[model samples]
Target: MTANATLSPADAVQGQLEAYNAQDLDAFCAFYADDAELGAYGGETHTRGLAAIRERHAKLFADFPQNHARLLHRAVVGAHVVDHEHVTRAPGGEVFEVCAIYSFAGGKIARVDFVK
Candidate 1:
């Protein structure tokens, strides 16, 4: 747990998702805690900590400007949010649906597990 937490866990995740849709790396990263962890689908944790997360996502955003994630559904239980999303990168690129489970602590996202 951390201090000065102002946004609700769900709200933080929502903001981050919104920022993600806009491809705004800075805004997207703002909702993560300093020591946040992201676990990739069918893989180990690809990134840990805010700086690493930012760099990872920044490269994604820059590499694929047409990348977009559409929130199909969401469920919130306590400090956890599970989001069903449809993601696409460009017209000819891979398009897939994924479920992302987010764990929030101190009003920010502390962990994320992506299921594809």
Candidate 2:
């Protein structure tokens, strides 16, 4: 079994959240599958594949150097993990709440749907 196979669904989600808060693109992407998809809760896909996801977040991290997401709550259901996050673009800057539903496959995140 690979190292990733040992991580629980919630653990994978939490690791990605930590990496995202740190603005570490590679580390953040590490938690996702090669063909991972990112999109709105019930809308169109915003990003497809790991590279696309990385590119999207790279711009975000560059634009908001102090970006951070605080975890308000989290729930794990089978192969899915749902997280409630409060995100800040910068200190005293734009803030928003988001609900992210993460789908896991083979111990890696396969898709993420966001609800704002």
Candidate 3:
């Protein structure tokens, strides 16, 4: 276990799910730090502000209107949580799984990195 194993931060995974299910990019991105880093789909690492994250999500939603994320597993270790999720396109299409690690500083996520 990492350093966060003892703190056991609150379950923020549900909020993440709700944010994505609702397509609320702002809300979804709210789970990060002011200068958070996101590396989704094993692509180039993005070190940007929250607005950039919002814009990215907006574009994604526009491209895949029926996309949704389902949290499959979650491990809380102090201020860090590793969430494994399955993302589906449309009602029942292809499912892609990714594991995201969230490290929090204070209450906001300082780093978010994931891979398929």
Better of 1 and 3 by lDDT: 1
**Residue range 6-99, candidate 1, lDDT tens digits:** 8766677778888888888878887888999999866899889999999999899998899988889999998999999999997889899999
Worst 10 residues of 3 by lDDT: 1-10
Of candidates 3 and 2, the better by TM-score: 2
Report lDDT per candidate: 0.86, 0.91, 0.71
TM-score of model number 2: 0.95
Q: Tens digits of per-residue lDDT for model 2 on 1-116? A: 12266799988888898899888888898998999999999899989999999999999999999999999999999999999999999988999999999998888899999999
lDDT of 3 by residue, 21-91 (tens): 88877777766557766776457777576667777788888877889888888888877788898899787
* Poorly placed runs, candidate 3 (over 4 Å): 1-10, 40-44
As for TM-score, the candidate ahead, 1 or 3, is: 1
Between candidates 2 and 3, name the one with more favorable lDDT. Answer: 2
Model 3 error, position 83 (Å)? 0.9
TM-score of 3: 0.78
Alpha-carbon runs more than 4 Å astray in model 2: 1-3
Ranking by lDDT: 2, 1, 3
